[model samples]
Target: MAKLVDLTKKPYNLNADQIKWVEDTIAGMTDEEKVGQLFVNLFFPGSDEYSGNEFTNQEIVEKFHIGGARYKGQDSVQVQGLLNELQSASKIPLLVAANCDSGGDGATNDGTYIASGAQAEASGDTSVAYNAGYVSGREATALGVNTNFDPCVDILMNWRNTIVNTRAYGTNADSVIKYTNAYLEGLTQSEIIQCIKHWPGDGTEERDQHLVLGVNELSVDEWEDSFGRVYRNHIENGVEMIMAGHIALPEYQKALNPSLKDEDIMPATLAPELIQDLLKTKLDFNGMVITDAAHMLGMTSAMRREDYVPLSIAAGCDMFLFFNDIEEDTMFMMNGYKNGVITEERMTDALRRILGLKAKLNLHLKQAEGTLLKDKSELEVIGCEEHLEMGADAANKGITL
Candidate 1:
């Protein structure tokens, strides 16, 4: 069995006020509200006007009390307006997140479009990578996106890894670490909570996790030297969160549990040994561990629909990303907790970590101050002359050919 980390100790070391806020906030939450905190629902900025979905964003916010939201493909102004509306409607402040990997352009149409990792590496200028993160972080923060799912630190060891080629820093560990660290530095400077993704790495597999379960076939020692090294370095540097991929580490699984059948070995996202033991204990990662989209075939295909919430919670995941039906999923989690499949202790632990992250981001203070993205000047920075010039400069310098 994977040893669990002490959940009481504050990883981010919240001060007394923040600690009190987290405790009080969690205490005030009902079971449904607590379960909702574990989910990061998909938020389409312009979807409110479409009339296709029965529940509007505000309705969902009121219904679920969702902790955060993941956004994609909206203009800067639209994103800002929608986020402000959602945040205002929520009982607790929402942690707005986006896949702002390439820059804010990755999530929004009007934001600065920067070069990919391949292009940045081709420039032979690591500064371009840093600038890419900075521009992305800056624009994301200005637009009320507090969390960014970016700086994909996966080492592309497989030549046939199509999904992560441009997304990842490089094929080599050293280059990936250097560029990733530099990029994280820039991103963190803007105070946007950055999440280093596809933990235990992702590029070794020829298959994409989006379609099927991806496996990293490296031995324990090989992983220690490559993916492990990059993740360890970042964890030590105080990364806010780590997104565990659907990829399986067979060697680690077999070594940890020799009695288990081959069919019983699961992906890192649903394996306690991988998450609670390997990641939490061995890696000494004190930050939150979120799963990749639960709606993906990589996750859903491996387990029954009802097992998703309970199994993932047992696997020590702090948050679940992108369920097919937010309302149904939220109800499933609530029912799981009530039925004792997901223990209250586990739920509280997850809530503490989630709330701790929110406290670290000072969401409580921001909520009280009513200062979240209220500044017109900060909003003006989105796709401004200076940012656009920076993006163009990065593109010019980052031409691969």
Candidate 2:
């Protein structure tokens, strides 16, 4: 049996009432609702081009009972209005997220484009990175985003790596840690939860996971000193979430089980040794673990969707990212649960952590107070002059001769 998590402990820190809300909410859910809680679907408010299958936001919440939705719109007003609609439609408060890595512009066209990881590092000031995160939080919250996927912590050891070269803070662990801490500190001040990314680390391989599988070929001791050190610091610093990339960490997998063959190795999203053992147990990360994105070739090519869909959650990921086909993927998760592929213990564990995240955000409190979203007046900061000037200042400082 999996050991039960102490909701009252660190990370979650749910009070008695909040704990009750988490437990009672899960207890009241149907099997379908429970299954739905495992996914974070994509949304493009402005166009049908990215709408997954033309399912409206209300339909998604009603039909899927999804735990979260990531906004992919490019307009500020559209994104905010759509997000408010999504939150109002759901029975449970949705964990709305935006890719705020560069800045608020990651979510909307009118948002601030503060600085890229490379630019922030080049500025020679951690405060530049801090402002980037703070401005991202301010604009994102103004647009109804409660979660941010930013501060790509993957150490850029391989310069040829396409995915994280410019996105990463620096080439070494110490530099990456310094800027990531500053960024998260600024984001934390805004009360929007932070999700650091690409676990087991990326940027060690030249290939992009979106196009093909990428491996972090570091030896156990080498990994422990570099990428492992980076992750340890973030986990200890109280990051609310971590995004498990499709990249493989073969060395650590082999160290844990000597007899395991090369073919047995899988991405962090489907490997129990990595997710359950290494991340959850060895690293002692009590917060939620969400997959990078399910549609990437690195994840899809490894196996058929039917097999890997359930294996992801069973492997210990708390939430799956994006839907390839809404109806089919929803059924796949439902069938996986019904067939006992995802055991009751595992299901409950995932649910508790998912709800624990919402409870930590005090979504329940905000919902009851009818203040889950800020007023339209708050949208003034989306691309205001002040934030634009901050972005310009950071850019000028980051300029190199």
Check candidate 1 and list the clashing pairs.
none
lDDT value, candidate 2, whole model:
0.88
What digit string (tens of lDDT, one per residue) describes model 1 on residues 1-401? Answer: 34433444535767788878888999998887898888887877888522245788898888878888877686877888888888888888887888877777875788887778877777788887888898889888888888888889998888789778888888988989888888888888798787998977889979988899888999998999999899888988888788989888989788877876778878888988888888888888877889998877778888887887667876889898876766567777877888887777778878878888888889888888887644556677778887788778887887665
lDDT of 2 at 120: 86
Give a tens-digit lDDT track for model 2, residues 1-27.
244556787678889999899999999
Q: Report the Cα lDDT for residue 372, model 1.
A: 61
Measured by TM-score, the strongest candidate is 2
Please give the TM-score that candidate 2 achieves against the real structure.
Answer: 0.97
Against the unseen true structure, what C-alpha lDDT does each candidate score? 0.82, 0.88
